[model samples]
Target: MPSGHANAGYRRLFDRSGLTFGAGFPLTGTNRSTPDPEAEIELAKHAESVGFDGLWARDVPTYWPKFGDAGQTFDTWPWLSHVAAHTDEIALGTSSVVLPLRHPLHVAKSAATVDRLSDGRLVLGVASGDRDPEYPAFDVDPDSRGELFRESVEALRTVWREDYPELEDRWGRLEGDLDVVPNPTEETIPLLPTGNSRQSDEWIAEHGDGWLFYHLPESTLESYIRQWREATADKPFAIAIRVELADDPAAGPEPLHLGFRAGVEWYRDYFRRLEGYGLDHAIVGLQNDDRERAFETFAAEIIERV
Candidate 1:
């Protein structure tokens, strides 16, 4: 949270929690037919005011029209820009931009712009895209995404940190004295790879600044964390989770993929568990099963509690 924004509140909260807490956005009102950007901005501002560490946005291309759970359901860059302009202190993150479906040069340019605009609060999350519908539209082979994703990441680094370097990659080639303008602070944006994306655990630990994983039982989660720590031996780790709150604190566990449907007390206890596991960040996606009630209830009982 040591961002370009000159807000000491950001620094204080980060220092006190020793963990990054965030909320995913595009708060689609359950009964509303479409998203309202203005309303969303208000929600984002509220999240920041309440001392959340970061805010995450998801890219939902095509929505497949039926993915049912389109987190942000918007173009990644535009949404990030909108949020970055409005927020003064909280770190802005993309859950991930599917690298294989995009040109890394474009990503590099756009991300750097956001970083500069936000005073260096951008943390890019990249992944080998899933959702087969998008592959055909982009002319990207889903099967080859792993290789393309790897190459794109390399290309981004070249364009950002080097000038006029000879670049050779499966995607294409670049030569001459050229570099992406307005490089991000630190000379690079932190690249957090979601899941494995066909990269081995060791490979991820070696290359990624952090690993993004779905929720898991603490023991299982710790095992994966241990593997990453052993492999990296010199880097940090990050993790995230999704949760749906029941008005009742004892609502009990209901099955949710990579997450859970529970109560405020349960959520706080679980977050404490994750922190105990040495997680540096936790981005919670508030499920939309009950929309308004869920948002208000969780924000009051759980979000503030954490």
Candidate 2:
């Protein structure tokens, strides 16, 4: 894919070489409970001020206690729009929207609205619905989610790029007589399919503008990046990691949820290693009681150094 074809958010958050770092939303301490709205906004501004490339928001329509995370506890569209209004320059991303749970047209409209509102700072990350309980609650078939995921991606592209495009699929049909309004800031918003969305690697590589992956060990991540490079030459590859910065600057790495508890020096090395493997971006969630200090430390110690 040509670099110029992507939206500002995509370009700002990714590059052909090296890695850009982004901060995940709900920047307050990790309690999984509802975070203060005011504090979140403040931390968001702080993140951009410190030079983080992007800010990510997750989509969790309903709270599933068993799942153990509320994911910002708000709808992705409004929450992102709110964040966009409060900050400038920092890219705004949907860590992922659950595509199969919502209609494609609705997703298209909401995504484009945010993109336009943010002046092309929306990088949409979409995923097949993962929570089993969400399937029946939304009256959607879990068995057909893979197909729905594919169709949703196709529908979004059609509605965004074409005027009243004729699109017929398992979801519904667009007759070419009606059009979705509020096109994205660019020709189309960057669509990054998350964790394969139950689709084949070939399907994802062919359809997605980029790919969003979960945290993996260094060796495993290298293998995945090698495979991704083989599949697509220029599309970006991003991973999300839960990071806890140890106060001691030289503390060795200790395993945590999907990431690590390490000193600042270790993080710098880790990010450099990721860049060496051709990883484009890292969405980091800081686990700390003092969110402000964490942002500053990460900016000075890891993001800047890397």
Candidate 3:
């Protein structure tokens, strides 16, 4: 189950048996953009201390009032760097960065720098832009994002693997002179494509080191896992799950839009079923105000046992 990169994050994710869990940020789970920064850093450290395998950050360039969630409220690189300084052993990852909104060169340089700083613990998840307003904001045509995403993924591989390799793309042209440095701690970092990003499933399985998907229904997820396994044997499949841990251990599962509200035993069984169906990782987001209690309880009862 090696995902080509020996980076700690990649290994922790793809090289494991069954499913391991990670905490998604903001650990506080506030619906708004602004969160207490100090609290977030502290919770991040606490999450690692309690045996979570990884910490994930989201890439939200701007806060849209209509969308109602600003996603960790900090640029992915700087915020993750701050957290990286405080924790050891816990892998750091971008739940995803929107590739179509950014210049590939900048994305490569920033990601590689973080990979180096984290000592090969970074797992980069990339995606095409989703919001329609975002396309206009970035002066990009909405229809062109799919191709842009493909080109960005290609550009990232080129810049990271070769020094000043000649390439031309929608963003710019590279003439084999200037290079994006400092190289990652490994030969290159792993690139997990989030969702379809407007590409065919075959295209994602072909190019992605792994796949980052959102929560899906049981039968649908099982079907997706089957398709992914058939296309790329042993490539990782991960999803972000919203968890509401009920106090009673015996509580049955009550579904949320993209996750579940249940007690530890139910979640344990639920994750085990997903693991049995070939899911490698579950990025859990605790949607409770008492995040500390929820995190500790979830880890002790579910993560420890599972």
Candidate 4:
């Protein structure tokens, strides 16, 4: 199914079948404090060169010690812009920007700027924020995040798509007088609401260009896809999974974090099953001690072969 957006990056990633692959950023391995910038860029280039369709960046506003994940340890805007400068064709995406923590105008403006600069390569994944401490630090009420998230989505769409949209929401009021300049490359930026954002499935289906979800069991994933199809037609569905590719081609599945440890053959079959179940894309986090070798093995085995 084709994505609603006509942008090349969007089309290349979402408007395909048979499980298009994407690499998650920082492209560095887990439990790392800071990513090596030069190596990360090289890896990003490698990912694009190897026929990966997209690269995903996460939004972690303030790193919480308790949260235990630094999330690329770079601000999303500048990070994406830097990545855009380095790569040519791969789509750039936010794993999710925490909407309630940021004003919609800023989110809209920054996103539009990246979209234009990247030549329409941005796909925004928005969330209602999960970290409890971040809410107080940002001066947002955790209980009200769901409402703020909905309002922010509305505001972002209005500012991007309408020339002088009149909006009177909690974010602020625009009287149809001033406009947010440097509008997106497309009429509307593709928005994929991540994990419901505290809204109903019907709401996400109606509002989002697609759905971005975490890894789920096969049966559960199929059920979710079936429900999504019932809610809307043609919108894409994407999932992110953490994978550790085993050396032996015939190695079977073993449990890992949010994904599994398996051989190329097992993954090939697993992804084919996902494709059969109507999945549009899979964003993979390669977990290995050797990053470059892991990427090469994945490309040679799963990506190129699958």
Q: Model 3 clash pairs?
A: none
**Candidate 3 versus the native: TM-score?**
0.97
Tens digits of per-residue lDDT for model 4, 76-111: 999999999999989999999999999999999999
TM-score of each: 0.86, 0.97, 0.97, 0.97
Per-model CA lDDT versus the true structure: 0.72, 0.89, 0.88, 0.89
**136-161 per-residue lDDT for model 2 (tens digits):** 89999999989999889989989999
Error of 3 at 151 (Å): 0.2
- Candidate 3: global Cα-lDDT? 0.88
lDDT of 1 by residue, 114-155 (tens): 878887778777889778888999888888988998888889
For model 4 the TM-score comes to: 0.97
Kindly report which residue pairs in candidate 1 clash with one another: none
- Report each candidate's C-alpha RMSD, comma-separated, in the order given: 3.7, 1.4, 1.1, 1.2
lDDT score for residue 288 of model 3:
74
Alpha-carbon shift of residue 5 in model 2 (angstroms): 2.4
Error of 2 at 216 (Å): 0.6
